[model samples]
Target: MPLDRAKTLQDTMTQWRHQLHANPEIAFQEFDTAKFVADQLKSFGIEVQLGLATTGVVGVLSKGEGDCIALRADMDALEITEQNTFAHASKNPGKMHACGHDGHTAMLLGAAKILAESGTFRGTVVFIFQPAEEIEGGAEVMVREGLFEKFPIQEIYGLHNWPSMPAGQMAVGPGAMMAACDTFDIVVKGRGGHAAMPHLVVDPILASAHIVTAVQSLVSRWVSPHDSCVVSITKIQGGDTYNVIPDEVVLKGTARWFSPELGCEIEQALRKIIEGVGKSMGCDIQLIYDARYPPTINTPIEAQVSADVMASLVGETNVNRNPIPSMGAEDFAFMLGKRPGCYGWLGAGQSEDCPKLHNPHYDFNDDLLSLGAAYWVALSEHRLI
Candidate 1:
């Protein structure tokens, strides 16, 4: 019955999603996207609040005196160029909704329209349209701007489209759902000289290579075998000429872990490795490490509530109650930290070869729009009742 109610608006939601996909905006620059969302919420007769985190929008719908809950959806796109040949392909060059944020925004909007019209719940529902989820930490910005302080929201919920799972499936658990993300940069300084006479100068490139190999030990050797951690050197920049070695080599990379204590240990061990390698290679290496998003951990009760509601829509067998956590990071962790909440993954994959998130060829599955919207509505009604 819940899914049927949402299916009635699937066509309208798909149109909204396509419109948003065609005009993709990134980060805090979601001005047009914010206006579109505000216009929709106002048309639905819900109270709209704007200007939080610059482009964030909140739509409140209250029917009676009861608990207040918030459902969030990200609205920003990524910086990757589009590769799809569909009619809804991105119009903006070098910007696309490769991460399914358009689908997320549309689904939440659909749920808002249904809730506003039906008024099936007794309490208040807060619809949060967030921006800059790619890498700018927009959720953190919203929290710092006093999101919870302004609204008496007791619980929050967030959902993201997962490409690895089959369409219409759902996953939620009580522990960490996403890993903490941290970045580091190492600048190795050495003496530059001709490549032909390698003995005459200190090669920072060799030192950088050693640093990379040594940092892998941070996960394999330094961290426990039972625990999970990832250290990747994403960027390496050093020399321009083939005949000479540059004086400095800059290494940029990221570290991921679930526990805060493990995060600290990883950073400390990483700094020590860099310092030792620099000293051994006769180079001066400067390390700059920044801790970004924290692990997304869900409260037990809220996670159970989400799972129960999901089961009601698509049986318990379709729901994954104990799925493994992902290494990818989400800014929604900031909101979960501030309030009791749960973050879930809605499967969006259409086939085994479906393009993954952040890929240029990736597109959100429109068929899942109704299912996701229905899940949101069901959760709202279950919690409010």
Candidate 2:
């Protein structure tokens, strides 16, 4: 039954994906994109609700009587300039759907259409189309705005397109599917003086250099060798003239960790290292750390359900249960925090040798529309049955 429906739905989804790719919108600014999604849901006789997080859209479909399951798709584009030479290339300047969100949105919409038409499920399905996933936490905002309270969902599921995996292959895991992203900034205060006269004033540039090298050792030496952590100093700013020592130096970077305890330990170590170095060098240090989304942890039972559903749809051999976890962060972690759920990766494959997400050359693989839509349908049917 899904095979026949997949064929027809594939064509429709391709068109929808192309339209979205051509007219990409950035985070929190998905006005037209939200309108298109809402209109499509309304046309299919699904109840549509908007204005959850500015441009967020939610569609509800109730069949017989049972639990409510929610499916989510992010609707925001990156700030990258489109480099795809295809006819459906992004028309919005400096904004492109390099993350394959166009495909994600289209696939969920396809599932909605199938559910609306077949009505084979015995429960309700809530389709969430969110915005600002690239910058501000769209899922976080939805939760803050009473998304789950207003529409009571039992389990939530999210899917992201994976470029490295082969087409038609799916990856799912039980815990720590993605990392927690935290950003930090440190400013070292010192007195400016002539470069040739070292004894005249305290130099923060040298102190910052020492701090950078010392911070790198925290993960390698201080933290457990088995644990995974990344501390990278991406930016450093200081003085202007070469002959004069700067009064202060600023350091900016990000930290990623899969374990919550390790994440906390890293932050604590950073503070100690920064302040210790500052005090030793006769300088004052100010540090600010902002925590983003938490690690994406999949419930054990839900992970098994997701993997089983994919295996049933596309053979057991095509479904991978122990795929490697990614260090990148996902806002979907917020939704998973509220309800037991699982997130899986949909293979996008290599198309025109496009670059990865956030790259200017990256574009969603439209050819995988049928497979993605079929996966969504199979997951819904399997869960509800």
Candidate 3:
């Protein structure tokens, strides 16, 4: 197997991942990151292209050209400071690769190097190093700027590191693998007055409190009980002083669902909650709902093929054929919307101490570097065969 040969590149891949982790950049600002990826691709004699989505990079390796397939890796980091005191900890103070994007980038680069050096596959492989996948919509921008139109690709694939699952396990499904992302900003406006005079003020904060509890009912009451969805209020901004009541409360959070109808329903439910509660509390309400990503749904044929390919290396027992889809959203859904593809999860969790994605103490497991590279190589060969 081509992927089996990637074992030799494990150390090299780990070095690359560590370097990327040290210097983290967020969103479309992956200038240094893109250059590094392009340089590595060019060093391997692969064709490199830049500036698709400002800082996105594409590397093409072609042999006899039986078919063309794409493998994507996100290159952006998050806006969190590094807590790990390791040597390769993030150099940037306010930015960190908390979501294992460094690992993702390194693994794909490893696969590219192996494929280029061996020339064992007869098809073309497009390596996509996408910028701004951490909450920003770099994938959507790439699609809008003619990513599929530029490359003659039939099938594309993507993967993310999974800290919740065991390191050797893999998961991919035919239906929704990730949910659609809808972010909302809500403002509850009320009269400001003395804190001690409870009856004198309308109290937007109290109204906001009721709103938080009311929206939770949307999932069980409005949407189907069985559908996978989420309504979370992550941030609340309102009061500045301790003794005075605030005039308004701002609620910021996200809504997630597998289907478009459910996404719409969630938004409608939020509006209803805000309006119904605002009217009863004598407060003005405004909501801004931005649908960022569609659900990452896998076509049946592509999902089956990718799952089978992954099982070849990781074993059938470790492959999760019926794993529950995550409520967290993935922007790769935009890419899949344009092409036939599958997105899988490469398990990186080792023990109970393993931190989940976006956590301050999180780090990409270097052990999965070679395994991920192997999966990419195996996927290309099996799909293009």
Top candidate when judged by lDDT against the true structure: 1
Q: Model 1, residue 30: what's the lDDT?
A: 98
Instruction: Tell me how many clashing residue pairs each candidate has.
Output: 0, 0, 0
Q: Give the TM-scores of the predictions, in the order they appear.
A: 0.99, 0.97, 0.96
Tens digits of per-residue lDDT, candidate 2, 1-385, equal 6646877988889999999999999888999999999999999999999999999999999998888899999999998888789899999999899999999999989989988998578898999999988758899999999999999799999999998887788999999898888899999999999999989989999999999999988888888989888898999999998799999999999998988888878888999998899889999999999898888999999999999888877789999998889988999999999999999998777754757778888878877787777777888888887
The global Cα lDDT (0 to 1) of model 3 is 0.91
Per-residue error (Å), model 2, residue 46: 0.5
Question: Over all chains combined, what TM-score does candidate 2 have?
Answer: 0.97
Report the candidate with higher lDDT, 1 versus 2: 1
Clashing pairs in 3: none
Q: Write the per-residue lDDT of candidate 1 for residues 1-385, one digit (tens) a residue.
A: 7799999999999999999999999999999999999999999999999999999999999999999999999999999999998999999999999999999999999999999998599889999999999889999999999999988899999999999998878999998999999998999999999999999999999999999999988899999888889999999999999899999999999999998889889888998999999889999999999999999999999999999999998889989998999999999999999999999999888889989999999989999899999999999999998
Model 2 lDDT, residue 215, Cα: 93
Best by TM-score: 1
Mark the 10 consecutive residues where model 1 has the least summed lDDT.
259-268
Candidate 3's residue-wise lDDT over 203-253, tens digit each? 999999999998888777888877878889989999989889999999999
Q: List candidate 1 segments past 4 Å from native.
A: none
